[model samples]
Target: MRAAVYRRPGPAAEVLEVVELEPPEPGPGQVRVRIVTSGINPTDWKTRAGYAGRMPDGFQVPHHDGAGVVDAVGSGVAGLAAGQRVWLYLAAFDNRYGTAAEYAVVPASRAVPLPDDASDDLGACLGVPALTAAHCLGGNPEALKGQTVLVAGGAGAVGHYAIELAKHAGARVVATVSSDEKRALAEGAGADLVVRYTDADAARRIRDFANHVDRVVEVAIAANLDLDMAVLGSSGTIAVYAAEGELALPVGEFMKANTTLAFVLLYGLSPGQLADAIRWTSGALAVGALSALPVIPYPLEQVAAAHDRAAQGIVGKVVLRIAGN
Candidate 1:
């Protein structure tokens, strides 16, 4: 089996290499998947560039999400069967083998059944972005019904899913974007209103459009704090998924509005929380409510280029074509 391995963290060209290795066998409660496509997320590149931490093993195959056919199901795995089409999540969390290989072994629970109608490319885009969006939107679908949800970076992978999921939950979705292209992307994702965040009156526009936002799915909390605060309704929650540096809370303002700031980190989610996210994401996928961003593909040998592309924060999903259709 051919795999892309990085023994050390550095620039993509310096570290990523494709080589052949024996296909790993599944252990009890695990499954071996013949990978069709591997999806790249910001976390994938960040880990590779040494932002997250050192590699867990001597060498690492990068990418936590993928779509593939089940080649073998280990003992004690009942729901998944050999030859089933599935999408994997967190395949490289603690394991050395990720989805960047011809075959990958992962816990059976991480491999969710992909609906027949869903494309393999769509399946590969689900794991990180979809799950993070689900978690950020809260667990109960009914919780968002009839409310207004504001999503920052509406054209981003997580923001794209957040828009779709919020709409599925019956929310009036508003998205903030920096350009006309992103505005169109957000609008296509079913947002009720797309506001240019660069506009001087962006907060006013959002507030006028929705009266007040019940929730905010924030990407860059530190950068958008003022705008988010301006449109946030009383008692609303700002669910932050990504941020840098420390935040100086406006205690008085928060107290007056009775607002809450919640942080969502995928890796820190409790088992129950993670389960809820997966369950919600799976349901959304089953009904065709979830859609993938535009995909940029590269073959296995060009994994380094894929990493570089993903690291550039392109508006599309970066994927590696592992197996031909």
Candidate 2:
């Protein structure tokens, strides 16, 4: 099988190489998928750069989200079988053998049946961003309904879904974008209020618009913590997806308000949690309540370029078309 293998933890092009390796077969509880598409996320590049200072000891593949057909199934895998079309999550999160290849063998539990109406590209892109957004919004059910929820970085892939899901769950949604163009996109995604964050008064202005937001779906918690602390309602939950900076908490503000800080990690979530997220997200997708974010598509051989594009801030999900059925 041909795969994009990482030899080191440096620049993407220098370390990630397309090379032929032995094809893997499914283990007792696994399935071998002929990958049709692989979705790239920020974590893919961060992992390659060794953010935690841990690099793979040997050659390893990268990428966690994938859409593929089950070409083979192993013993003890009951419900799924060969020829099933599926969307995979956590494909290469903890391990090095991810989905950026001609074939990938993952645990049966990691694969979910693709919706009948969902395209492969959509399925591939939903695993990380959509699931994260749905999980964050769905975590606190009672307060989400009839509450004003602010989604920070609204034009982002995850933020876009956060807006949609919050609206679907009955929240009065407000989204903050960094530019005028993105404000329109946020509105299109159903945000009731769109706040532009281009001023020193942005946080104050946002508070004026929302009055008090009951929840915040935060993307850059580190960058936006002060503003978030200032605007969130008392007892509100700030579900942060990416902190990407110092781990210190807003001790004074949060303690004063008794706020709840809920951190979300889409990949590596426990099985039960992921199952519930998948159930809701699948329902939303099936009913057209959730829209797949814009995708920049590339052929399989352009995998490196896809990764670069994703890192360079492509508007939405970056999908690599592995093969066409």
lDDT (C-alpha, whole model) for all candidates: 0.92, 0.81
* True-structure lDDT of candidate 2: 0.81
lDDT of 2 at 271: 75
TM-score of 1: 0.98
lDDT (Cα, tens digit) per residue for candidate 2, span 1-325: 7888887787777787888888888989999888988888888778886774767869778888888889999999988989888988888866667888988889898888887777888778777887898777865444478988889999998898888778877889888898887888899899988877556887787778778888889988877877788788998888888858676786887889999999898765787888877777766776777766777887767777777888888677888777544
**Residues 1-325, model 1: lDDT tens digits:** 9999999999999999999899899999999999999999999999999998785578899899999999998999999999999999999998999999999999998999999999999999999889899999997678888999999999999999999988988999999999999999999999999998879999888878988999999998888989999999999999998868888888999999999999988888888988988888888888999888899999999999999999888888999999554
Q: lDDT of model 2 at residue 114?
A: 83
Each prediction's TM-score against the native?
0.98, 0.90
